[model samples]
Target: MATPEKTGDVAVHDEIQPAPLTTTNTIPDEYRELDNGEITAEALGGMVDDLPKGYYRSMSFIGTMLALCLGQSSCYFGFVMPANVLTIINEDIGPNPNYVWIALIWNLTQAVAFVLVGRLSDLLGRRWFFVGGQSIGLLGSIIACTAHNVPVLIVGSAFIGIGAGVQLSFGMVVGELIPNKHRGFGISCIFVSALPLTVFGPVVIRSMILHMGAGWRWSYYFNVMLLTVVVALFYFCYHPPTYAMLHARRANHVSPWKMVDFVGVLLFTAGLLVLLLGISWGGSMYPWKSGMVIGFIVGGAAILILLVLWEIYGAGDYPLIPIHLFKNRQYMGTILTAAVGSMVYYSLLVLWPVQITMLYDTDSMAIGWKSCIVAGASLLGQGACGVLVRVLGKHKLQLMVSVSLLTAFTGAMAATTPETPGMAVAFIFLASTFLGYVENVALTIGPFCLDASDLGLALGLLGATRSTLATTAQAIFTTILSNKLVTNIPKYVVPAVLDAGLPQSSVTDLLTALAAGNMTGVPGITPGITAAATEGNKQAYSHSFQIVYLAAVAFGVCGVLAATNAPNSESKFTNVVQRKLHHTGFDNKTTKEAEA
Candidate 1:
């Protein structure tokens, strides 16, 4: 086996280095565990990339890959399934204005957990974390499926969000296990696993809502089952190599927990929570000008500032966020692009369904299939980009072209009208396709630039930054869209309905029914008045949605600038495996036992 050189207590590699040549004659015995679960680094064997090309074709490796893919699919479910069925859920559970929490809390928990989870997984092994995360998601599914109120549902969403956060951290695990050159393909495999669901998940959810009484809850039941299988798969299939440094630290009586930056964790978690809370509350639960909103925003900003200062000066050797990563142009550019791109996508993900429900069709099935086009298009884009990157290997150009095209397409969406629904669909599909390309570059590029030891921290920071920024952007977009709808409805719909011979006394009821997409019992309502009111409602939603798309276009311009800062690191791709899976008897081991 090739021996790894060490620096102090940690094993550090600044760049990808080819493993030393070894022959079967020089190979060591199969890794045997000590009674305490620790195995020496020498016994752990050589890098998997150094093995023969077809060495990874074994069933064990395939099972491991399947588990990773399934883990990613569960995260996708947590994000996509809930948002699509939220309105139906609210209808069954009463018209609670706070129903937005079902989505917000999911995002908020992830934004708060990414940094801590990433660093901890780096210190601790990843297997249990992956399994435990899915288990939590299963528990969350149970809770959400059984919820009778919005608050209960929000609590369930929070658990699922936390689980998704850890599942996202598995990106680091995927990077470490795959050869560096094949990272794009490896990462994309997990993403592509969600493609089937992205394309058809909405159809299934809508069908359930329409056909079965309380069938929306059945979606959560399916989630529970999927997560159960994911947890078991990860537990049985993922058997990662035991690192020597962990054993070294254990022998010296060092504690992994001691290395944690508790203060930084507190500051970051609290700050993100407060900031997102303030943003979510603004113009929804409270006015933007409310003292409560301003106070929370300002306080969160202050705490975050303190976190930066602490991470730089106060946290000793092991800061929660590695300070040096900020200096790498490629890493920073990737993070910025990913965050901004997600913000742009959020404009479509959150608002497009609302646009469909208000203007195009209220039938659950139609709304489901129609609103899912962008997601399906994005999946195709992601798959195409994955293959293209593997073949072409020019990420900078891909990012540049994708962001440029995405900007043009997103800006065009502002021209959507009730008469031009086809135009909106076309532009959004084009925008989403390019957005997927941008996402592909952002998700895979960071590993190329950073060292192997910092993989967990880097991936974690990327996920957290993207989640926080996107959540904040969603709030801003919703506020702008809501404010515009409030203004435009009164200006356009009120006049059109009144002119159609609708009585002034019944105007409020008529407007409410139009917004709700049900005109069952509005006084003085006639077919002519309904026709005029429908047209006006469509016009109001079109105008409001246009403003939201215009706002996303502004962010797209920023994404273009961020993409420029990214380097073309085609040379960094190589057949270097940072950490190889041991594939031994890890299924029965506890974390402390494994490290001992």
Candidate 2:
């Protein structure tokens, strides 16, 4: 009556016969009729020798580490390194309003790329996308390095985001290579691989920007070097089975174009873009109630609703995003976790650095060191999570523990007023450590919850969620911070400025400068007024960050709720491919121990 539990990851190496999709009645026919023969070991195209079922256990570690290191390094290169010198870029561009487009364009495009690339890779293969993303990223860095104007830099940022988006899907590729048991450790290693960059990227970039004649341009040049390294590693070290090798035997003669739900793609991408475009504009370029903002926001939401309808009914056989995926409770729950973690992660990525700069007497190097604490703690947390999952075999517990810490620490951050350097360092490290655990657990558990066929799409969906939510979070906090400053600066500094002997003629200009947060830098303010204005600005930032931290706390609480909704999972990894092989009688000798 008692069934044995699965003790270890499924080690199935031989490719299983394609199973019918569980939920859908129709399968897209594009690759279905293409290659009808089974993929023999010789189909490797001279890439490598035949790897056995569960072969990833032996050769998988080193191969996975290399791929992860290269891929994630390229991806985060867009996210992290930019924050190190955003202010410098803003200054160099003469504080142009359009400068925000650098990050805005990058995140928007990256969000689109994440979903589209993931969907395509599922149909085609991941190799060319991997190679292409890095190549394009490298090209972007080159352009950015030489950029003389803000528009040129914005173009370069677009390339960086687009490439990084595709590179991000490599997580699923890594997921495919490793079995479940050691997969968390392998994922941890990928996050850890960025330690060197996180530790040194800012310091080096800041020094280059501040002292080297190359200025902020050197930041992109360094990105180029990192991208070049990833591309090189990819060629020699990467070799995974293509979708064609695995499923082309089942291909129908349907045109690939017919299989592509272009309408869905358009609706999905346009809806998000318009929504984010509206969000980005609100409280920054335009008022929230402005016609342009309201129209785009309403229109984007309506279009997205249309997308849902089409995918569910109208798309017939070819929905852009497979509709059944949304029905998978595990996939849906964990993907929301990814989105919330991203929202928290990205908002802090910008806000924390600003908080540290304004609250403490620190230079960019000091801020860089502070950032290293986060990176180091994340690596530590991720590595430790792998161990905990191995010993305890409960990833949901890890998720719970992570969100608990995140919620508490974020609450603490919200409470601590006038944050000192010591407080900033300690809080950042602790919060980041917990945040890292949450992310690693979500990402690692994602593939395990779905059938192998859905890995790319699921991960793509997660990638899209992460980017979109992050952008949304950024908009939310940027509005909160800017709105607060606009409200509070007058209350705190105006009386002080008017109280000073400055002329009444200067009042309008003074309010304008204060609103711009140029309290000290505004040209005509005397030393006394400048210092008072500085204090007022600092108070405004401090209060604004407290609100953001509180929001982060709310985000963490939502992560816990989301994790609670996860479909019950067995503690360790299940090799779906191997399990399917066993079920189909292809591997009848499956040891009882394999099922534990």
Candidate 3:
């Protein structure tokens, strides 16, 4: 149900046709029967109650969902393209230290925006927010495309991040639109559609960088055009149900500025961003004991503590996150499971591709294919997860088993020797597949347990956890690996270079390059020296990955233990049994009693 995006959440509802669907605007007489149970109280309750005219059921629904899917994919695609060409971008923009902020700004801004907008979106409908965000994102693309300096590009990325924050809202929209029976399938489609771009984004970017004859700026330009059409299509294709339109007009006397948990948003976002910055800068750009890093860590901790206290004690009539959501055993359990899964998988994402390039010496395309296998398999795993949950009748155990196996499997990969063939890559694929399952377990079970009113908060929290936790995990492990590489490379490298008859002066230069992670550069060295340098660098990096994978195994085991806390309140994992009603009689005693 979750896909990565930089935007806010989608609105409450969506539309769809029934089984044995038809494409024609005119429904056949037989096809009309398919509509019998198409609309349900659970599906339509928090969304629109009255259908709009010309809101034809079948293909129209698909078009709306498709547009959403494409919009999200573009954000991801745009994000990935820059990452692939960071080196070129760095070269083009000069060696300004601030250029790093191009990506960092997007990440922090998006994280902050998601937390703020999601809660406000519950009070305010998403139509205008959605359009405004797209407009802002387009502006970001235009800025980046036209940028002549690093600072300008950083500003552009920040705007893109704000716009992308709403991407998680698609889950809320999807859950409201599709029936419980079809929710999983619909959710899978949205996530799966991103795979094509995830798999091919590197290749496309590489082509644009290497052979397309266009500058790196064209990548942003291309995304801008693509998103433009998608925004237009979404504007035309999506028609909020009458209830959603009505909901927009009703004041409910709730001014967003008054109702929003601004203090909580400020504290939580500031705390998390500062903490991540401390983690990222600690051991690389600055020493852990540096005053700046220490200040960030200490201040972030204090702010986070205050955030929790405020959420519990001071939030009256408008909690940032409903207290009951945290108290709910299932919801908390899913959060734990997802956070651990994200940490492990993102760690793998950071370490494995490096492992491939060092251990196998593969090119960017080979890495792309291998990366695709991992991501493509993950997409397949997510789609099949809905079916697996359907058959298993309970997702907790299935997730536990998956995480347990992943623990053993991750450790198994750690045991690999440098000479191991595709064995490491194969295990990476398997590990990624299970990681997808762990995420889908939360996705599948979440909508089942929470009421429609809570869907946006639940989904926003889940998406935020996956992203921020993974980022934190990456910073931690990358620090570990980098520190280890700095210490270990001298031991394994200097002696090898001296043995290969390279002069000490030459060896000194070589070590400096390797220490900076530039194994491909020679700086006017002999072929034999180059070969020795490459082999020595590979040996050093391989050892670092061993530590990373072993740590991942430990997290994987913790994931298993966390899954045990999840509720088995229902035997069935599919949507069939959990029919949450958010209808008009919500306060009625009879309705409450029957639900209980």
Separate clash counts for every candidate:
0, 10, 10
Better of 1 and 2 by lDDT: 1
> Across residues 266-304, which tens digit of lDDT does each residue of candidate 2 receive?
999999899888888888888889999989889989999
What candidate 3 gets wrong by more than 4 Å, as runs, is 1-43, 46-60, 239-257, 504-506, 516-529, 569-596
What C-alpha lDDT, on a 0 to 100 scale, does residue 473 get in candidate 1? 83
How far is 48's C-alpha from truth in model 1 (Å)?
5.4
TM-score of each: 0.88, 0.82, 0.82
lDDT of 3: 0.65
Model 2 residue 259 CA deviation (Å) reads: 3.4
lDDT of 3 by residue, 60-87 (tens): 4555677678777867655656865576
lDDT of 1 by residue, 343-394 (tens): 8777678888888878778777788888788788787777887678767867
Q: Give me the candidate number with maximum lDDT.
A: 1
Query: Which structure among the candidates has the greatest TM-score?
Result: 1
The positional error of residue 366 in candidate 3, measured at the CA in angstroms, is 3.3
